[model samples]
Target: MTKCIRCQVDVADNHLNCPLCGIKLRESIKDTHVSYPEYPQIAKRKKLLVKVWTFVTISIIVFSLAINALTWKVKPIGWSPILSIAVFYIWFLGQDLYQKFNINLVAKTLWNNYLILTVFFLIVDNVTGYGKWSLNFVIPFLGIATGFIMTLWSVKNKSMWRDDIGYILLILGVNVLPFILFLLKAVDVLWPSIASLLYGVMTVVGIFIFSGRRLLYELQKRFHF
Candidate 1:
């Protein structure tokens, strides 16, 4: 018998994968194996990132509150920064909940939703209020960049990255397509309300398709029933 590296379960000598855990088993003992310590190291790095992001989120909230308090009399439609802070807080909280509950799919869905909502809110707020800020642009840009980084990390860790890739594409399309339409003055040619409705439908469809696939794969792998 040989041991499954992931679940530590013993498998029959002739088995190619662990029956209980679905972990791939070596055909022969001659295959080089990763050390146990490496698993802990990866976990440690993930924990550290979580801590750092939490700290950054808290700092943003505190700083925003302080600024709002100091400039209460001169508040300039404070929605931009407020929305940015809200986005960061939601992202952080979603990640924490996912880690605590091991609800990876829910966490990913919330993360993607918050990211796209942040961009839409920022653009609408800025355009309607005739205000522009560098940070407004920064939030969405960072969202896409960080999404890509997380996808790459997931791939390296042997986790599911397909859902992430789909999310990144969806966000990119949502954020960029609006600008193209605006440049062409397509809003005058097309009804804004109808366009918005179609966009919402597309976003929901994309999430459903990608998330459904991941759910099916997980159920089959874990229960096979």
Candidate 2:
């Protein structure tokens, strides 16, 4: 309880000032209020930086598009758009996902590179000619790389993966896409699809060897079997 010297009032609340006297309370008063460090200024600065980076990146994209418009031609199809994409990708990496320190950086980089390259190839194919590489090789390889990483993660951290294996298995099911593409006669080359099939098989074998009984546990949990 804080006693107001001026009003001779005994206050029962915890505050820096007297309720009736409206004067500063003594530091020796019991039951001091809880203190918390202020971080709003730092948070505001971070937000400001994000806004600045967004503006700068958008400006660069506009400039690249202007250049591309001026240099539109045959065969090359003006490479400025590629430059813009690259710049945007870098900005996203630096500003958005770079601070995610807990995630596996190597796996993140591989997946990001796979998607970015796939997009770049799609653009190039659209401008020049569609060789089916982006749809055939690029997408399938992305799945292969991601599956490999997920398998390694599960094997390396079996104790955790014991409970989380179902999601990983479901995601790895994308590797079946290439084989489906082949069966639909969507792709003339079978080697890429065969490679994806081989990757899927390897992953399954790895899960059996490394995950073992845990894999069965996760499967049962997933399927309610």
Candidate 3:
């Protein structure tokens, strides 16, 4: 067996490449042994858990739709859609936590979930009589929390800072939206928006202050400059 330098995993001589990353391997004497450990029982258990979770959530969504259909005349607020979106968000969250993909992919998944929840609550707010709570409070505060968490995580995992900086910047762009909406009168309460914007600005400033020229290099590389 030969080891893949990148993945640091053993590869059988019969394989021409690393199984995980697909990098070509150095020539070696032919062997028939498995290069990686096999956990058939654990794999089966995970698969069973996934199937059970999917079946349960899908059943709940279907039941909700049926109930909504039957009660359409009495209360037609499309709460079923909200429930469905919540389910989807939960599935994303669970998958991210369980699969533990690379940090960049996890960050993007979270960002996508953020967008999904933004739209989700907006729809909920509109359907529930446009209370403006979603915009005035929920979204802005959510943005602030997301940005703060991303910055904190990136700082904690300094090794992946390059992978996270671009995403953090993207999140900061999202943070700008709350205040912009406030300016356009789309958001009534100013405090949450101001707080989000302030947090976003502070995050960027902190990155610049601490990262120094590395931040510039990362920005340049990300922008292909």
Candidate 4:
């Protein structure tokens, strides 16, 4: 549509001057004009997958609530509470997995396992009317099992709680509670509690032996008092 008089070259990009010669371009005397490509306009739309997923989750929640209400009416034995707790836990776990759930395998493992034990014991307590099994048996064994897992995972990873050994030590401390209950004559089944305490003690001793003074210094820094 234009020509650079100095360079005698045809320019077609709607330039005011020649690209190479920097000379002003002269417009053509043609009746017609050059046309460039034009992009088509598109309408914005919502993400279908997200909308579907949200709708499904809402429907499930509503259905669960209706089931909970009906079950409670037929036999009110804490079934509705357990269902509510389970739903809440499911939502929590989903969010955890969706977000940053990479590191701290030990903590996540313990937390989830404990949730299972908690729900189980809650059901047990409801079914039995009134029982100490949840506290005497479930809590002790689950705590010991959690400690064993944390110890095993820490050994496997080698970098867990190197700076902050408090969590590990706290688990080991809880391992002593069952023995205290035994001494107080609170639990009928003492053997299982004793076994759990032994396992926790052995795990702590193993860590101390293998980790040596590094763990001691870490413990000192963590305890201070």
Candidate 5:
């Protein structure tokens, strides 16, 4: 039997990867193999599609920017950035949907959404005559919502708490970002930043108080500190 380090489960000798989280086992046998057929060509086609799509999107962005620059005096609406953001979002969302079919990458999807929406709104805010709504309210609330969703996800997968500490730490950092932004005077609202910071602090404190020594061990193993 081969043991999966992430899920802490024993895998059969015939399986090279863990059934749960798909991590490779250290003691995986080279000669032992499954009866499933491989599809290398499908993966290659996917990669080719991604490359082609990226090139096409970048070309579109360049063309739009060139046109916008030529008509700067007549139409200075800053529409190119919004168009570029939309194109990038479609590409990223497509990639996420493709990967999510194979792996449980919901946390990564949430992080991607957070980044895309934050940037999208910031661009929109700037384009709309510096409304300041994105930094003042939207981003901090978005971070809080993301952290909440991630927390619920960890709870739903209670069996994988040890494996989940990394995500928790990452979300905690996300929660703390609003405070940093406030300190830098980037975010005008103090209440939202304080709320996000307090939420993150409470989550970390709850984990430490409840987990005790196991949390320490997991932290040490994950961070190598």
Candidate 6:
């Protein structure tokens, strides 16, 4: 004799399903026998990564400010990489703001700021006789803005892990975009062209990687799957 755990009905020895309830008895047996692994260390590692990123961002801002102050009297305004420092500060500030406020509007504001600054710098660089500053300023700013936007979107929707991964990839892609452009222009490298092409590929990939599950769920619900 055996028991149906679901309905507490008596079952025969050779039976797989509960006769009265029609629940699978074998599944209950398998569930009780199987073990799941604990993942506390994995959780700890993720927390550490967040802390390290936070510290690194702060250090970069402080280091950039220190270098700027030390070189203020010696370096030309156009040559001083203040735009680079500004991009870093803005990127981290956007992350902090998202974490604190979980606001889509802030993300949109940052994106707009990035575009405006890029255009403003380009005009200044072209009109006032500064070379390459516009390109230097725009690329990283766009990358950081993209990463921040994805991150904020993820945060607002409670997809923190996927959001963090997307943010990391977006940052990497943004940093690499300028180098790819340079290589294509200066050396005529096909690899840089490929790399630049990959920006679009990776953005789509990141979207799918992070949002695929949610999208699938929504689709299933919408279509009655």
Quick one: best TM-score, which candidate? 3
Q: Mind giving the per-residue lDDT tens digits that candidate 4 earns over 141-163?
A: 88887877776677678755562
Between candidates 3 and 5, the lDDT winner: 3
lDDT of 2 by residue, 1-225 (tens): 878889898887567788876898766445567789886797677778878888999999998888778766643476776777788788777775533344434444545665676687777665556787776787778778776776576457653454446545654676778889889987778888889888888777877886689778767777899
Candidate 6 vs. true structure, TM-score: 0.33
In model 4, what lDDT does residue 190 have? 85
Model 5 global lDDT (CA atoms, 0 to 1) = 0.81
lDDT tens digits, residue span 127-166, model 1: 4673433233444344445454554554565454434544
Q: Which model, 1 or 5, shows the larger TM-score? A: 5
- The best-first sequence of candidates by lDDT reads 3, 5, 2, 4, 6, 1
lDDT score for candidate 4 against the true structure: 0.68
User: Model 5 over residues 29-116: C-alpha lDDT tens digits?
Assistant: 5566779877689888887887888899889989988998899999878999988898889888987676335334666677778899
**Candidate number that wins on lDDT, 5 or 6:** 5
Q: List all candidate RMSDs to the true structure.
A: 16.3, 6.5, 12.8, 8.2, 15.7, 15.9
* TM-scores for candidates 1 onward, in order: 0.35, 0.63, 0.75, 0.62, 0.71, 0.33
lDDT score, candidate 2: 0.71
Looking at model 2, report the run of 10 residues with the lowest lDDT sum: 98-107
For each candidate, the alpha-carbon lDDT, in order, equals 0.57, 0.71, 0.82, 0.68, 0.81, 0.59
Worst 10 residues of 4 by lDDT: 40-49
TM-score: which is higher, 1 or 4? Answer: 4
Model 6, residue 162: distance off in Å is: 15
